[model samples]
Target: MSGTVALITGASSGIGEAAALSLASRGASVALVARRADRLAELADRIRGEGGVALVVEADVTSQEAAVAAVRRTVDELGRLDTLVNNAGVMLLGPVVDAPVEEWQRMVSVNVLGLLYTAHAALPHLLAAATNGRRKVADMVNVSSVAGRVARNGSGVYNATKHAVGAFSESLRQEVTGRYVRISLVEPGAVSTELADHNRPEILETIRQRFADVERLEADDVADTIAYIVTRPRHVAVNELLVRPTQQQA
Candidate 1:
């Protein structure tokens, strides 16, 4: 990854932040995108302290304009774009019957639309890199969830968004794999992150109880999976990767 420039959304925390650090450590110039400037700055400082090149771009991926600008800014500042991690997403879980429609809107906006906007903006750059850059191959890793594969009672909207991600990733992969741009989907079963913090109090308690006996995965664990996907040889394209904790069944 020495000559690569990778941009990651939701990069201020969780799997996004971990992936940024991991790629930077492997010698990739990383561009961190997220809504939080302070957190991005903190992560950038950490990466720079380790002698890695890190660029911080503050943007909300839910908006198409912001998403496009983030991608453009990354390419302009980093010289080239080799990898895109569409990791900006939100999970607001609850029953759909009387649930707040705002949660559903938020999930669709970030998980589905956000991914689309970033991919749309970054595809041309990724293709260009694959054609002319050092690696001769580019990667797009979409961070989905196990919820994408399994639809539970309380997470209907979240399930829909992730399922959409899986569909989009596969279709895009088929379209671009021959072009040397690898599109991959990463589904994580259950990770300990701030994702659950956005749930309502009632829903949060239910989730806590459901996973109380299970040892959830760490952010770095999923980050390692992402690193493995992008670092593979050009011929070896990891199309889809599902990571689950040893104790997680679904």
Candidate 2:
């Protein structure tokens, strides 16, 4: 992880934020991308204060232009790209019967479209870096969810978005593995993250209650897994990792 350049989406908080810190601690130059400029700046400052490199990029990953620019900015300032962690996602949990249409749209846009935007822009650079001796190995890690694997009733739209990510990551892995570029997907189950705050209050309360009995995994749990994925040797490509709390059933 040391001396790697990592671009983390949703780096302002939660898993994204934890990934930033974990990578930085191991000597990765982190590019923090999110809509929250203030939070990004704060995190960057914290990383710098601890003698690590960090860049704060304010943008909505859902925008193609913004996604491309974020990658450009990272390469421009940091010199090269080593890893891209697509960790930005949203969860709008509710029954399919009367689920909010807007929530479904938002989920699709942020989770699916945003991942594509970031991945598309970084492909050329990752491919180029992978062939070089100096930067022989580069990684692309997409953060999906347990919902991506299992279709839970209330998490239908969320599941759809995550499933798309899994499919895309696998297909991309096949395309780039021949080029020596690594592509991986991290499917997390019931980790404590800000995703819950995005849900409706009543729904949030009900969902929270289910996990109340067990000690849920922290955002850093997923972060640690991402750090491990990108830090592996150039020849090693971890296709997918599903990190779940011991108590989680679905």
Candidate 3:
């Protein structure tokens, strides 16, 4: 990873932040993308303090223009892109009936549209990297969720969004794998991230009750998975990885 450059969205907190640190420690220059400028700054400071390279790109991925600009900015500043972590997403869980339509809209915008926009913008760069960059391989890691595999009563929309991610990742992988660009999907179960905090109080209570007995995974756990996927040998592509805490049944 010494000459690699990685751009990670939702990089201000949780799994994205951890992944940035993990890759940077391994010698990749990191570009942190998120709407939170303050958090991004702090993270950049930490990376630089540790003798790692870091760039801050503040943008909301939900906007297509912003997503495209984020990708271009990374390439303009970093000179090359070797890995992309599409980690920005929203999960608002609740029963579909009588639910606020806004919740569903938010989830779709962030989870589905944002990922699409970012991936579309980064595809050409990733292809170029795989063709001519130092490693001769490029990686795209889309962070999804267990909801993608199993749909439950209260998590219908969230499930739909994650499932969309899975489908898109697989199709895109098939289209790009021949070019030496690896597209991987990572599904994590019940991680302790801000993903669950956006729900209404009632929904939050239900989530607490559901995962009470389960020791949820930390952000670093999923970040480790992202690092592993991007660092594989050029010919070896870990296409899909599902990580769950031991006590998590579904």
lDDT of 1 by residue, 1-250 (tens): 9989999999999999999999999999999999999999999999999999999999998899999999999988989999999999999998889889988998999999999999999999999999999889999999999999999998889999999999999999999999999999999988999989988999899999989999999999999999999999999999999999999888
- After superposing candidate 1 on the true structure, give the runs of residues whose Cα lies further than 4 Å from its correct spot: none
Model 3, C-alpha of 43: deviation from truth (Å)? 0.2
Candidate 1: lDDT over CA atoms? Answer: 0.95
Worst 10 residues of 1 by lDDT: 94-103
* Per-candidate alpha-carbon RMSD to the true structure: 0.5, 1.0, 0.6
Worst 10 residues of 3 by lDDT: 89-98
lDDT of 1 at 125: 97
Off by over 4 Å in 3: none
- State each model's CA lDDT, in order: 0.95, 0.91, 0.95
Q: Count of backbone clashes for each model?
A: 0, 0, 0
- The TM-score measured for candidate 1 stands at 0.99
Compared with the true structure, model 3 gives a TM-score of: 0.99
